[model samples]
Target: MEITPIPAPQIDLLLYHIQHHPAVLDDKTKHLITTMFQKMQDITNHGDDERRELWIPADRGTIEDFGDFEEYLTEGEVSSRDEFEELWLSEYPDSIKWYKLTTTIYENTCYVFLDNKLIFEVRPVLQNNDTKDHSELAEWLLSAVDNCLTALEKGEYNAFVADNLPYSKRIGKILREDFWRIFPEEKAAYLKDITPDEMNRFFNLIQTQPPDSPAKRLPEMTHRLFLDSCRLGYAANHYAGTNTLSSMELYRSHADGRDDGLLDINEDSPEDFAAWYHDERMRSGHPWEVCRGGNSTHISLYARCDNRGWWFTLAGSSYSRSVETVKFYLALNDHGIPAFLCDGQELAAMLAGKDYIGIVPGEVIPSYCGHLFPDENIIDFMHLPYDHTGAIIEAVTWHPLDRVTFS
Candidate 1:
C-alpha cells in the first residue's frame, strides 16, 4: 500500500515538541524521527490514493489504554501511562486537564492521539519491496546500537572481537579501564548513524576476503612467529649457564661417536647430525614448558656467515602458555635473544625495499604464498600456522643480528 501524507507544518511542530521534550532521545531515535518526517514530505509532494483511517478508542466508561494497542503499532509505542502524561504535559502545558498522548508508526502509517481523540495521522512512502517491512528494519537499527552499548558495558570483549568489528581493541580497553565516560558521545553517535548502505559495504569487505584470505592470514602467521620467538628467548636463557656446542662442534661430536663405536653408523655416512638434533629438540614438546622449569624443547645452532659474521639459530615453538609469559620474556631481554611483537604496519615498514625470505606454510605450498618469498638473503625462519587452525596469531618479522619483534 502507498503512503498517506501529512502536511509539512504539522510535521515541523511535532519535531519541535519531541526535540524539546524533557526526556532526552538518543541520536538513533532522533534520526529515525527525522527520516520519517522526510519520507512523509516526499509522499505529500507526490500524492497517492492510500488513505488510512484514524484510530478510534473504544468507549467503556474508562480511559483508553495505549498499552493494549501496542501490537498494532511499531515505533514510538507508548511505554507507560506516566511517560505519556509527562510527554503530553510538556507539549501542551496550558491544558487544564492531562490528556493521554500516544504515538506510533507502522509501515507507512503513523498514529497520534490525545486521550481517546485522534489528533494526527501520517504515512510515509516506502521505497520498494525491500523496505516493505519497515518495522523490522527500524527495530534492527535501534537494537544494533543497544546491543553494542550493552556489550561494551558488560565487558563482553569477545562479542565485538568475534564480529571483527573496527576499534575492538579500544573498546576492550575502555571497558577494562572503566573509562567509557571519558570518551566523546560522537563515537556512539557514529555507530547509530551508520546507514544500511554503509553496513553493507562493511559486510562486503569481509565477504570478499574469506576467512583464509592472506589479508586475514598474515596477522596470525606473524603471531605464531612471535610466540615462538618468545619461547626461543626463554630457552636460550635457561641454557645460558650450561655447556653448549657450536653447530660444527655438535656435528663432529656425533661423528666421533660413530668412529669410537659409541653409536652404530657406517663410515661412509654423510649426514649433518647437528641439524637433525636441533629439529628433534624443537619438535619434542610445547615451548611454554620451559618457563615452568621443565625441559626445553628448543636448540640453538651457532653458525658463522661471511658477511653477517657469527649468529645463532633460535627455533621458536608452536605453542605457548599465556600472554603473561610473553610479557615476562619481553621485560627480561637479557637472554641475548631479542624478540619484539609488532603490528602489520610496523612490520611492513621494516621490510620495505629490504631483501627478506618468507617461509610458507606446508599446506599452501605452491598455491598460497602468504607474504613470503623462498629465496631472499634475510631469512624469515618464522613458521606459518595453517589457516584453519583458528588460533589468534600476531605479526612478527626477524632479521639476523637485528632486533626482532612478534605478537
Candidate 2:
C-alpha cells in the first residue's frame, strides 16, 4: 500500500494559525488537535503474503509544525512509535477508532485502514461570533481529506481521481469562501487555500487478526492455555466502539498494550495472544445438523455416549443484550462451531462444595466446580443459528457433557 502527497502548504498554514493566535486554545486539549499532530507513514509487507500494508501513525507527541521547533512534546519520552502510543495512552486510555475502506481492482480488492486518531483529532472549539459557530475551515479541512480518501476507494482509480481528485482543492475553495470572511487577520491569515498533490510511500502492515497469523501454530502448553481461556468463558465482547476484550476478556481485566498479550492466556509461544484468539470455537466435536439448516457442534467427551440431546437454552440477561454478546452466540452457532459456555454456576458450586471438576484459565491443576444442574438433569445443545448477526435471537443454547473428567 502506498500513501503520501500531504500538501506542505496546509501544514504551513495550520502552523501559522496556531502560532499567531494561541489564545483560542482551551483545556479541552483534545479539541485543539489540528496543529499539534504528527504524521508518520510507512510501507511494509507480510512475509509470503501477497498484500503489502501501509501504516499511518497518529498521536505523535513531538510534532514539527513549526520550522524552528517541535511542539506537543511530552515528558518521559518513549523511544519507539509503539512505545509512544502506549505511553500517551497510559495517562488517558481510550479505544482508538479504526475505519476500513474497501477498494476493488476488477477481480481483486484492496482495503484502506484509517484509524480516526491517525486521520485527525476532533475540533470542538467554537469561533467568536454572534452564533459562535464551528470553524468551517477546520471542519472542511478534515472532512475534505476524508472525502478524497474515500473517493479513492470506489471505482477506476484514475477515473475516480479525475472526478474526485483535488480533495484539498475543494477544501481550499471552502476556506476562501467560508472561513476567511469570519475571523480576524491573525486567524484568517492562516486559513490559506489548500494545496493538493499526489505522492507515494510504504508502511508496515499491522497484524489485523491473530488467528490467521503464523503465531497460531501452538505447542501443548499454548494449546492448553488457549483451551483454558475458552473454558473460562467471556462476558460478551465489550463492544462500546473501542473495546478489544473479545480476545478472552474473561481472563484479562482490560487489554492494555503495555502487558504482553500472550501472557493473558499463560502462553509462552512468544506470539501475541491476540493473534491466536480467533474467537472461533476451540474443541474436538461432532456437528449435529437440525431443522432450518442450523447445527450445533458437540464436545468430545471420552466414554460419553453420543445421544441426540435436548437443547439447553440460555437467555442473555438484560445486561447481556449487548451487540457483542449476541455476536458471540451467533459466531458459536456459525457452521456448528464448538464452544463451552459456562455460566460459572457449576464452578461456583464446585468451589463451594467440591462437586465437579473443570479446567480454568488460571488453574495449575484440574479443580472442582459447582454443579449447574442436579438430579441427574443435563442440558444439551440442540441447534443454533448458522449465520446470525444482528438477528434477534431469544437465547443462547448449550449442550451438556455426559460426565467431565479433569486433567
Candidate 3:
C-alpha cells in the first residue's frame, strides 16, 4: 500500500516538540536533534529551497542510485532492492517506519525515532532552566572587573590572559609586554572609582590639546585614561564615559597641509575648527573617518543616563556588538535598569518616555545646542534632550531623580 506524505507543518511541529522535550539524550543524539531542528527553522523562516534540498533526501528509483549502499551490508552479502528494504526494516524498525510514514517530507525525521518510540519519550528527564538572575548577573560583572583590578595590582599578567571578558585580551597583552614601561602602580590606580564629572572634565581637557597632553602630571596618558574611562562604563552604573578622538590630532593630521576644501586649523578658532571637521566627517557617511587615528579608542559610547548606557567597541573597522556590550546590558537589566539595543529613533522615544509624540528629525531637536555633537545625527542627539532647547524636544527624561522635569 502507498503511504501519503506527512505535511511539512506537522513535521515541523513534531521536530519542535522533540527539540524542547525534557529528555536526557546522549551527545550524538542531542546534537542530531538540535541541528535538524535549527535547519528546519532556518528553511521555514528564510524560504531557501537550496538549503532545504541539502537536508531533504531525494527519491531513489533503483538500489544502484543509492551510492555506497553496499557498505552498510556485510561482506559478499549483496541483495535485491526488495531484500535490502526488508533488511533495513527488520534492523531499524522504528526509523524505517518513521521514514516510510513521512516519505521524505522532513530532514532527519527518522533519527528522532528509536525502538518504536520518539527519542524524547523514550529517555525523558527533568528540565532545569539555568537562567541567571539580576543579582547574579550583577555579581558576575563585578567579579570580572574586580579580578582584572586585582590582576593589575598584583602584576599578574596571566590572570588577565585567562579572563574571558572582552577587555582582558588587550589589557593582558599590554601588561605582559610593557608592565613597567607604561602601566606603573600609580597609573593602574586611575582605573578605580571614576565618576561622570571626572570623565566629562577629561574629555573637555583633551578636546583641543595635542595627543601628548598631560592630565594629572602624566605625559601621553591618553590610552591609559581611555582604559580608566571604560572600566567605569563597563560596570553599568550612574557613571558615563566616551572614547572620543582628539580634535587636536585631527587638526594636525588632516587640516594642516590639505588643499582640499576641508576646514583649516590656522584660520578658524579651535572650537570652529573642531566643529567643522566633525560635521564634514559625519556628513561623509564613513564612521571610520571620525573613529580612527591617534588616541581614539574606536569605542562608540552610544547613550547613557543615570541608570543605563549603550555603547559598543569596534573590532578594527567593523562594528560588533561585543561580548562586553552584552554583559553590560545583561547586568543592567538584572539590576532593574532597562537596557536596550535599538536604533536612534527607538532610543529617542525611550528617552522621551511613554507620552513622546513628534517627528524625529524635523519636529524634535536637541535641547543642548553644542557645536561638536559627537554621535549626533539630524534624527536624534546622543545626549539628553532637555526642555530649554525647544518645546517639542522637552519631555520627562531619564536623568537623575532629583532633577526637575520641564512640563
Candidate 4:
C-alpha cells in the first residue's frame, strides 16, 4: 500500500483517523494520539481558566475498557485524561509518537497526520507573500462542494465535507472572519490542509438504503418488514387507511367473495362504531370498533386510527398472547402501500375462508405502495417501544384514499 504525506492541521487529523480506527494504534500510541486530538478540538474559557474533563478510558481492549472519546466528557466522569495517560505510558513509555502534516499548494489539496509529529503548514506558492488574499480558501472549499454534488449525481451519495465544505458555506465564513477575532492567526495554516477530493469521496459512501428496498419472498413480508424496521411489535389487528402516500404492498385482502354471514362485520356505520367493536372483542381499555366480533370478516373494521398516520390493533388473549399475529388493514394514499395485517385468530379464519374472502387471488393487488421501513435516519426518530428489535413489517404508510382492489 502507498502511504501519503501528512497535511497541515496535523494533530487534528492524527486524532480523527486514530479514533476511528483504534485497532491500528497500540496501547501507548492510542493514549497520546487521543490526547493530542482532544487538545486541538478542545473548547477553552476566558483568560486561561481552562479546566475541562476529558473522557479518556483507564485501559484498552474490552468494551468496558474503551475510553471516553466524546467531546463533552464531564469533570465528574471516571478515568480523567491525566489518569488514563499514566496507565498508557506505564504500558509503553518508550513508544514515541510520530506524525506529520502538510499540503500541496499547487494542487490546492492537503493531507494531514504525515511522517509522524512535525506539523508543517503549506499554502499555494503566493504571487506576493507580502499580501494575503483569504479568498483562495473560499474557492478551494467551493471546489469541494461542487465535487460532492457531482458525486451524488453519479450514484455516489456518501461523499464527505472536509474543512473545505464542512465549514464551507456560512459556517466557514463565520469561522474565517469572526472566529479569527479571538485567534486571528489561525486561518493561514488551517485553511491549507482541507482534502477536498478525499473528503468528498468519503462522504459519498455514507448513503443509507431505505428499509423496504429489499426483496421480500414471503406472502405477507411487507408487514413483517415494517415492524422490524421500526423495531416494534406488529399489533395483531387489521388497521385501515387509504392509498395516498408511497408504500409497499405485502398481501392484499379484499371483500370480493360471497357473504355466508359466517364472519362478517358492519361496514356502513361510522368508523368509530367499527373501532368500538374491535376494542370490545380484544377487551382492551382503548375501545375501538374496527375488528369487531372477530374471526375473519370480509368487510369488518380490523383497526382504529385517527387522521395522524397512526394505526392501532388488538393485542390480547382473544388472539392468544403467545403467538404474535394481528388483524389489520393499512390506511393507504400517502404512499403506494397495501394493507396486510395479521391477528393470530383473525388470520387463521381469513386463511380458512380464503376462497370466500379475497386472498391473493393469484394476482397483484392494484395498490400504490412504498416501503414502510423508512430510511434508517427517519426510523431512528421513532420513539422507543416502537423502536423494538424484532422483524419489523407491521408498520403502515398513510394514503388519501381508502380502498384496495385485488386481482
lDDT of model 4 at position 315: 27
The estimated TM-scores of all candidates read 0.17, 0.17, 0.17, 0.16
The number of the candidate with the highest lDDT is 1
Cα lDDT for residue 127, candidate 4: 27
> What TM-score does model 3 achieve against the real structure?
0.17
Give the better candidate number (1 or 3) by lDDT. 1
Q: How does candidate 1 fare on TM-score?
A: 0.17
For model 3, residues 241-293, the per-residue Cα lDDT tens digits are: 22343433432232213323332334434344344444545344332222232
Candidate 1: worst 10 consecutive residues by lDDT? 168-177
Task: Give the distance in Å from residue 357's predicted Cα in candidate 2 to where it truly belongs.
Answer: 27
Superposed on all Cα atoms, the candidates' RMSDs to the truth, in angstroms, are 24.9, 28.1, 26.4, 26.4
Per-prediction tally of clashes: 6, 14, 0, 94
Candidate 2 residue-wise lDDT at 97: 12
Which is superior by lDDT, 1 or 4? 1
Better of 2 and 3 by lDDT: 3
Predicted candidate 2 versus true structure: per-residue lDDT over 33-65, tens digit per residue? 332221101112333322222212112122232
- Taken over the whole model, the C-alpha lDDT of each candidate is 0.30, 0.26, 0.29, 0.26
Best-first order by lDDT: 1, 3, 2, 4
lDDT of 1 by residue, 52-72 (tens): 111111111112221233432
In model 1, the runs with Cα more than 4 Å from the true position are 1-230, 233-328, 341-407
